[model samples]
Target chain A: MAANQEEVKLLGVVGSPFVCRVRIALKFKGIEYEFLEENLANKSDLLLKYNPVHKKVPVFVHNEKPIAESLVIVEYIDETWNNNPILPSDPYQKALARFWSKFIDDKVVGAAWKSAFTVDEKERGKNVQEALEGLQFLEDEIKEKKFFGGEEIGLVDIAGVFIAFWIPIVQEIAGLQLFSSEKFPNLYKWSQELINHSVVKEVLPPREPLFAFFKGRYESLIASQ
Target chain B: MAANQEEVKLLGVVGSPFVCRVRIALKFKGIEYEFLEENLANKSDLLLKYNPVHKKVPVFVHNEKPIAESLVIVEYIDETWNNNPILPSDPYQKALARFWSKFIDDKVVGAAWKSAFTVDEKERGKNVQEALEGLQFLEDEIKEKKFFGGEEIGLVDIAGVFIAFWIPIVQEIAGLQLFSSEKFPNLYKWSQELINHSVVKEVLPPREPLFAFFKGRYESLIASQ
Candidate 1:
């Protein structure tokens, strides 16, 4: 397929940490692509057909071939574009990047966020403690580094975009104070840098609306209890 | 660091499916490494130090730098030793391999296996049904291909190693019959090929002992109910 003729498209939902990873990657690599907003309530046929397994966004379609999972899509973009590499050149360093990215996605974000959202107060407190410990681990990892991938904003930073933007909003809505500057100074500093970065700033959803959206969900969760 | 002088080591347990992944990948690459068996009951300081976050095996250490997570370690091995390439050279193809590999690790192995281990009979049946559906999805994906990554036993094959060896033993011990040749012929064929492969065969725990080991665990799980 010809380079110019090949169409690139991203199917994603706004305010999703996963979707933001791909969008930031695309912009950083200076790739031009169409962005299709997916209504997750009633998912689009394209989204379902493209990603039959997870059926989640952001799904990156290049030359009509679909690739799901945010980290996978980001890696694909890095490989295809070549310029402004998100992953390190050395194999070992790249492996380290992938390891931390998976950590942030699976443990820090997946487990911690789920815990913060739990309705039961006692269970929520225990999970929140565990989640804070996870964040502390990350804080130690990112100590004195400009970004998770070092000097430049790379794959690990993109993977942790949730910590920069989404989590604070979630904390507010859930009335939970899990990640605070006092406890996790390094991570708090990193989050500020991440949100302030030019590329990240472009894709981040406005804070007030995001807060309002999650507030409703949090209230519903607590009301059921 | 001199290539010959560099030390390669794997921290693993005999019957762990995750450990098998790194072992097979190392064997495929013809890399010689010392294997350290971990007693999960009292985890060694070495395993704990290497994988502080998860503290789970297998941890792949090269030149004393530890890399945890099976898929990450496999990718690191593939990149470091380029002789027998597991991941496809093409970026797009590589992405597809990663997507499916993550699916097998996260969905097929993680969720389905947990369901198979459920103590409640009714819940186990529901989970087993869901697991079968997941396997059918894989069976369809594999279609007529000799392996997941085509002719070669690539990353996807390594990731799905659990389905080939561990699941059968788990089914037997749990007194469940989730995967069968009649239901998932392709995966069944793939499993046979996987276990019989010279490199894989070397690392596989003897079936009888594996069965006994899991039977004890399954009995305990049921007894707790």
Candidate 2:
């Protein structure tokens, strides 16, 4: 069991891939934190206070300071605790990891989310195509290594996990497959290997509930469009 | 003068903000690395061989392994050499820095660049609005701190120099001033303080040529559109 750090807390909404990232990072570092579930429709005062600009969840409060953004939160967790470092010690390797992490954060998850939300078929297809290009880029980039950081779950792998976990939920909602075994064999295998980790599996909310939640959100968004 | 380390070499293009980031990181860390400039239009065989997929420059070659991405390269430099660690040892503070870094990297610089290049008045306005929003967010976030990392130039500050240096160049090329003292006072002041750093100033290419290059590119892009 991790230490009961009352000084440390995490504010997040359920079913958010971004929040899930922080959860996994905390667990990986064996850092205990209080989890405050936020409502997107009605954000908590703490959430608002912590991330006044974004007003989004996954805000890590430690010793009273609040940190927003999932990847940044994860990096914070790794750095603050001095536990299992998520990034490599080598500068070159770390840069490679950051590159892939940024790529996935921007292209795979970000673009896919946009595509799933867009109503116009043509616009949605363009988003999806760009999302696929991002995936292909991931596939090609990962060719040289087992994991993005090479044989271990680093910053790159954690960031990339958003695509793997959320893609399925998103696919079920969008009624279109973005990443297929045939199209991205390496990524497919790597994702399966990633989620199978005990830490990752433990931190992730039950997929069924997540699927339903995202599905409803996507449908409502599409309907509005 | 830094020692010759055959173990370290940087492959990049001249005048690239991304590549300049790596150069600054190396110089800051007092690490010796040979610089190899690339022609993005006609990429060198080495650039392709190092970063095969994107064929992008700013690939840091260390002990023969290539690492891509500017932010990642910064991390690599911090980790590889223990001197002048760019990130804080504390986990939460590190996350706060990473959060702003990501926010600025993905949003502020991104929107500003788009605003600069966009020909559509409506789209340009939208992009400029977004850029302002991003800057506002940064201004608010940095209110409590001296630097993005607080007190000293750290990872977040380095990651965010994109706005400091490149935005000025973009403003010059686009003939639109989005960041003014009246508009974004803190960011404007922050930019002034940042660019004044010898490392930052030295690493960044002169504005005149960069502006000319981007002006040509933007004009060509608008012409095509």
Candidate 3:
């Protein structure tokens, strides 16, 4: 535990995969932090002040020094606390971890989310195809490992909090079958193992409530478009 | 230098700021390595094999292992050869560097590039405004510091290679005077310092040819759209 753990505070809303990532990292490092839930519709002054550029959350403040962006915060936690090393010690492996984590964000999540929520049929089809292509790359990368971390929950696994928990539910709600156990057995199994992991399990948004929240939000989001 | 200096290979185009970032890092570290100038229109087979995911350049290969993404490769170089420490040693300060570097990519460069290239009058105006707003943040961050690294050319400075050298010519060729020294004196001065810095100056593409290249590319991109 950090000697200044008492000074740590995380400003975020519940059910955001971005927030969940920071939560998981904090838990993994055993750092005690105040969780200030922000209403996204009406963001607090703290949110605006800490993250003036993005003005969004997973803002990790330690001793009043705020660090926004989930991956940056996660790396900071690992470097600061050195308890359970989140990233690999080797430089090459570390770069691979960073690469895969970024690929998840850029390719997997971006395409998958658009596949789910886009109201236009042609766009959604394009998204679904791109999402599947991205997932195929992930599937090949995973091969037989239970996690991208391979026997430990490292940065890539933590960065993949969305794929493990959120995307499946979103896919189900949006009625877009972009991911399936049949299509991607290894990734499917990896997701199950990741969500079931002790550290990740503790921080997961309760599925029932998250599902209900997204159902309402997704419907309204589709309607607005 | 690494014991395997013979094995370090960087595959990228000359004018890309992303490629320039890796070059700056390598030159800063005083690493002697092979530089493969890639034809972006017809990417090499090695490039294809190395970066199948993005199929893009600025792929840093060390000892047969390739790492894609400019920021990721930069971090890898820093960790691999600790000769010149690119990131701040303090955790909080390191996080700030990462945040600002990312902000440069996500906000500053993206908006500035679009501002220059977008053919639509209204879209270009919006991009111009957003680009200036992004530059304003950088202006305040820079203030009176000689560099983001405070007298040292660090990751943020390396990351903003485009701003220092590429974007000015691009903005000029596109006939969009979005960035001006009068409006952003600090940033403009910082950019001047950065471009003239010994490490940065070595790999920068000649301004005349780069202007001609962008002039052609930008004109064609607009016509195609």
Candidate 4:
């Protein structure tokens, strides 16, 4: 690859777990990429043009080609440069891993993230309960299997790290407990294990920073009412 | 590839768009597998064990290595066999395609489908609006490309097909208009093109049967309360 063509750039905001997903994937693969922090409040012209549809951050640009959506970007990185493969070789096991990953991608952050803004106690409780149900499903389904795919950290593990790392912080920020360590022992243990992973550990923001940002954001969202 | 290791079998309920995703993938790849119809109300033990987690149908057992989740199964089929590839060779294009697929898979089905069941007109309207927004996004993003990845029916096309084929029937069943052909001419036209594909047409259920079944089920759901 030519020098200019070899560049891999990521446009994202700080304190975004979605952006973290792409960051982790790139780090794990040992791929060098320039990171540009976008102030989501005032997105760049390039960001708008590259991703006009959703216009969200964490856009991975590889050799000038832009790929929006974190998981999609991660998959693109994995496919383009095959270093540390995040997916398994066996087709069956790979499918099982993708299944759980998609489940997490679709449900945990997708729905559970909404619990922060709910005003009604009953409605909030329902949302929290639904989120817990998804967590329980993970706990029950991921017994004995080391990382939701059997003894290896793959795409599912990457998707789930959001819940394992960010959810507790989110819970702290929102003053809610969706995953009780006792109720979801397996999930709790898994979270701890994931936190210990070197790649995950390396990329994680300091707790104080994440907590401060999230707590302030939550407070603002509530106070705006 | 041994005969005695239990032939590849798919346990699925008829008329499930999720199941259809797996079916089209299998047929597209020209892979011969046994199709077992599962009665969801009284699910068989095999189906339960095959998909012990979700306990849902559309379980693909390849040499008894059971894999659940429709998109996962489709990807597995595409990877395991190599007759007709579904995803594109270009990594960027593939990522773009998967992003759209995941977007449609997670958003369109959840928000729009849930909207079909709500009692309040306001909530239902939100659902309709969300569905239309998703379709419009597809129209705008899918730039003059024959398929989502440029040409041929890829994963994005597959993802769209699930709702694409059933939305019209669902509208008729729910006595509402969520997917107006006028609003999403490109998507509507794409849906027609998808079903008309020889491979897709072969695997898809007859429109009337699926229409009747899904319509009846939704009606029953609304009537129960």
lDDT of each: 0.88, 0.79, 0.90, 0.79
DockQ of 4: 0.72
- Poorest lDDT segment (10 consecutive residues) of candidate 1 chain B: B1-10
Candidate 1 accuracy as lDDT: 0.88
lDDT of 2 by residue, B1-225 (tens): 234644788988777778877887887777777888777778889898888756787888887888777777777677677777788866666666666777777778778988988888999999999998888888876675656766677887787778888888888778888887788777777778778877778788888888788989988987898
lDDT per residue as tens, model 3, B176-198 = 77677998899999999998999
Summarize candidate 3's per-residue lDDT along A9-89 as a digit string, tens digits.
999988899999999999888888899999989999999999998899989989899999999999999998988899989
Q: How do all the candidates rank in terms of TM-score, highest first?
A: 3, 1, 4, 2
Every model's TM-score: 0.96, 0.88, 0.97, 0.89
Q: Write the per-residue lDDT of candidate 1 for residues A118-173, one digit (tens) a residue.
A: 87778877778777877988999999998998887999999999887888888877
Docking class of 3: high
Model 1 chain A lowest lDDT segment of ten? A1-10
Instruction: Name model 3 segments beyond 4 Å from true.
Output: A1-5, B1-5, B222-225
Q: 2 or 3, which is superior by lDDT?
A: 3
TM-score of each model's chain B: 0.95, 0.92, 0.96, 0.91
Best by lDDT: 3
Residue pairs in collision within model 3:
none
Worst 10 residues of 2 chain A by lDDT: A89-98
A29-85, model 2: which lDDT tens digit per residue?
A: 888778888888888888888888688888888878888877777766776666688
